[model samples]
Target: MSVSAYKRVQRDLESPRSVERRIFNRITADLETWGAAYDRAESKADRLSALKGSLQLALVDNTRLWSLLRRDLSQPENALPPELRAAIISISYTVDRITADLMSGAGTVAALVGINRPFIDGLAGISGAEG
Candidate 1:
């Protein structure tokens, strides 16, 4: 997200809001941050030996975020439809597997981004646009 956009979200968050909207904003912003970090890491890692520390940080953060999401989704009163929650849980597993692969240098950051892009769009109410 642009600085202006980030600022706007911050402003929006300062006021009263629904719990669902707050969660949505936080997740979307974090994804944007992770996406930018991954993009930067990919560019910096062209030499294979020059990987950025930001990549590791982003990966760890991504895992933590998914863990939180999974825990929340598992709750009986999460409010999301069952099918959508289940699908997200399934994708979280894929993210877990891919995160391990990427840690071992056998996966691309792009894969992680591809998985997240759709969720980001969906959270923003933009359906089915290519990541």
Candidate 2:
């Protein structure tokens, strides 16, 4: 392809929506892997270790996703309502608490899984709506 054409392709791949979708998909996949690892662990130590690592990965990815959403919401041209933006911010705070709790061994695998389900659903809805 021509240079311009190649640049266009790159731009399309890096578009905000495309980036968001990729992040969302990755988060979903990571959560699934974490769930499986948590479920298959055979001993208490193994289970705790698995859960800890899984929670760390999920928390990092979740943080990245929310940071992007916050950036978008902060843009002057963003069309999403103020309430929606506020809700997203609120959820980010909750994620922080959840991450801290999980890291401190005060949270459960089931709670992490429960928290991720709604995000997965929301991502799916966005994908469906865009498609």
Candidate 3:
């Protein structure tokens, strides 16, 4: 391949959109795995164990992802509209609340599943990955 083509490929690989899509894909996979674990848990102890391990970790990772997105959106060069940034901030707040509730044993698997669906859908929409 030409040097210019190779350079273009390298740049595309490192672009912010590519990075964001990769992050989103990872988060989606984690959520799916956690969801399956939650589905298979047959007892409260089992469910709680899953929640404490994979589910909690997924939530933390997701929160961190959103935090990074919010930070990026706050930069002057970010082209996303102000309303989109505000929406991200609001979702971040919800994620924090959900994480706190889960940690405190005040959350259910159903609640967590409910919270995850919208995020998964949104990620799928943005990444066009059917996640």
Residues 21-51, model 2: lDDT tens digits: 5667677577667756655666656656776
lDDT of each: 0.67, 0.67, 0.68
Worst 10 contiguous positions by lDDT, candidate 2: 122-131
What is the Å distance of residue 129 in model 2 from its true position? 13
Best by TM-score: 1
Off by over 4 Å in 3: 1-14, 39-45, 108-131
Which residue pairs in model 3 clash with each other? none
Model 1: runs farther than 4 Å from truth?
A: 1-52, 129-131
TM-score, structure 3 vs. true: 0.63
- Residue 5 displacement (Å), model 3: 16
Q: Which lDDT tens digits does candidate 3 get at residues 1-131?
A: 99999978887778565566667667757767785665576765666677767777887887788778768877888787889888877877777787676565455545544655565566446433544
Candidate 1 TM-score to native: 0.65
What's the TM-score of each model vs. the native?
0.65, 0.63, 0.63
Worst 10-residue lDDT window for candidate 1 reads 43-52
Tell how far residue 43 is off in model 1, in angstroms: 15
| Rank order (by TM-score, best first) | 1, 3, 2
